[model samples]
Target: MNQPTHPAGGDVQPQDPPAAYPPYQPPAMPPRPCGIKTWQIVSITIAGAVVAIVVIIIGVIALSGSMNRVAKEAKDYYDSKAEPYTNPAERKTYTNDTISFGYPSSLQEMSLEGWNYTVRKGTVSDRRVFGDKDMNYFVVYTQIKDDGHPAGMSKLQMKSEMSSLFDQAQSSGSGLTDVLRHEQLICQKHESNDFSDLTASTGEIADGTPVVSFHYVCDSRVENEDSKIETYQSTWYDHKGRLNTITVSANAKAKNKYGRDSINIPGLTARLR
Candidate 1:
């Protein structure tokens, strides 16, 4: 039988239903290898950092302790080498017409030969010398007439006098050379005789005395010997209208048994009239 046609249109064939799609599924992933978890990794990193910090702290503590020990050992070594001040009672008194002072009994009376002096005199009146057995170190205490120099001279005057004296020594072929140090020293009485407590002068000394100090090196003058002699001197005018000088001479090759640059000026002045 012939099919009926629609008006002004050709017959349309039936379309198949839309093909069905499989349910959406993602590609399968490979299995993971057995390993530490994220939290475990974090814990291990923190533990390593803590251990490093602990090691640093221990190293610092050990270094600090070593430094402290070294410092203490240095101090102890110097302390042992230092000579203590002689007790007043145990000290021996040296008395002369012009001056009287206390000296360590360990020192014996010495001669004035080869001693260097800043204030030269035709003859040292009322002089006393004391020194060690080897004479490597000695102290000369001498007094001279004021020669018109005023007592308690100013620092300028003292310096001028020192220059003049050094000039004289140089002129006289005394072999003094190389003025290593020259200055005014302000000294005060201390409860102990330790000279390490000496302080620099702040223009004036409160209840203290001022003295001029000098240091120079001289030829040993020994036959065929190339050694030098080191000399330290201190000069001050006392109220007695006299010039007092204390000289310390040391052999360049010998150690400083007194462990001081100069004698205790303040202590000696206290005992001087």
Candidate 2:
């Protein structure tokens, strides 16, 4: 028993120094994939929805504004034609020692808004309208107003000079649109005396013969405005020693219904004193 100790080396020998712990290696982990997270995707979706809603609301407001503008335009057009003519006091007969014209107070005022209407420019020296609130219709009467004749110029000289001026007006290219571009033919060789008061002019009855200008002038609806063009058989013109013209005004739809003779312009001309 005393010798049992003899087998073990008097004291325990130290184990090899712990092997330096291998520099603390951590477990390898795989890299995360490169992309948006679920929360990020949800945020983007919400943002897109907000933008779409805003766009839709803006579109609706714009459409409403456009509709309102169209309505106002129609109302103004209608009022311009209807209101003034409504009151008996608003309309009056035109009379002069040499000529008298205008609708009788007894007759109801007419307008395209109410029904198709006709206004005969039927005067040698005047212009009028049935429903053209824009005053698109006009009559131009010219008589050698100083015909380029000098105080002492001979009759032949005066006539020659005047002729030159007249030609200038006929072919004036400075500010005139080529009428052929806007003119749409409706009638030709129309009867005269039907829409002219020229027969009563002081000089040559201006009505060289009975003929009316062709029907249908294509023009804008508003005064001094150049949009929304429509054509109607509401215009007439002739030279009876004087230039007579009757301009008709109506919307496109109305023109289809009313026609060029809605006002009996010819009858009006013949009726005027």
Candidate 3:
């Protein structure tokens, strides 16, 4: 090493600091595209959540209405299929000159010990008074002992008598439900049914005899504007010249709305033997 004289006679000329060393750096990695930003992804998720909530609410409302309609339909179906108003446990047997059958004990014997409401020749010998919890009731009259028409009444007259007797008391209402409510009816032709036989004169045939029956409906609106309906049905039959009569009544509104029909036609006829 050759010793060199400093310029200006001092170390000021020591020289520029050593060239700056290059800055250190880590090794590079593979380049990648930026994915969705955090903020954008969060916003998208929140919007989706809101949309899902809205859909759930709409679905709930629709489901609720459908459930209500289904429930109502089920109730109406069951009501239509239910049994009649008569109590089945209390059965009573009765003997009549022309026929015999059982009836619900809930019916009260109408004629008393002294009062004999007798229509000669099965006109109206024995009767039972029956009503429902609503005080709606019916009367069953049968001929016993005195078989055949009244002494002087002809067969045609007797048949007419049986046919028209119970009908006179029937009243009019919405759909003709009330018995005492009097309204013109849309009468149907007498037809054979499970409960009664068909005949030329009327609806009833008793022990092969041509009896009489009339089934008609009254206009429910004729009675009360708000009343739904009033139902009235009657049947008459004869045995050995004796008569068997049955009357049934119902309130249509009460029955459909509250399932409270008090009439039981099948029960009354079941007693016929």
lDDT of all predictions:
0.51, 0.35, 0.44
lDDT of 3 by residue, 1-273 (tens): 998666675565445667688778888987887888999999999999999999999999999999999999999898666545555356566654554445455554543332234333334455554433332233344344365344444456656755565344332213222222112221121121211211213444334333434443332322332333334444454433445555443446434433443444343322223
Model 1 error, position 124 (Å): 3.5
How many backbone clashes are present in model 2? Answer: 8
Clashing pairs in 2: 118-263, 192-210, 192-211, 194-266, 206-240, 206-241, 207-240, 234-248
| lDDT, candidate 2, at 223 | 43
- Candidate 3: segments with Cα more than 4 A from true spot: 1-95, 100-123, 137-139, 142-201, 204-206, 216-237, 253-264, 267-273
The ten-residue window of minimal lDDT in model 1 covers 181-190
Q: Each model's TM-score, in the order given?
A: 0.39, 0.28, 0.33
The most accurate candidate by TM-score is: 1
Task: Extract clashing residue pairs from model 1.
Answer: none
Model 2 lDDT, full chain set: 0.35
Candidate 3 colliding pairs, count: 22
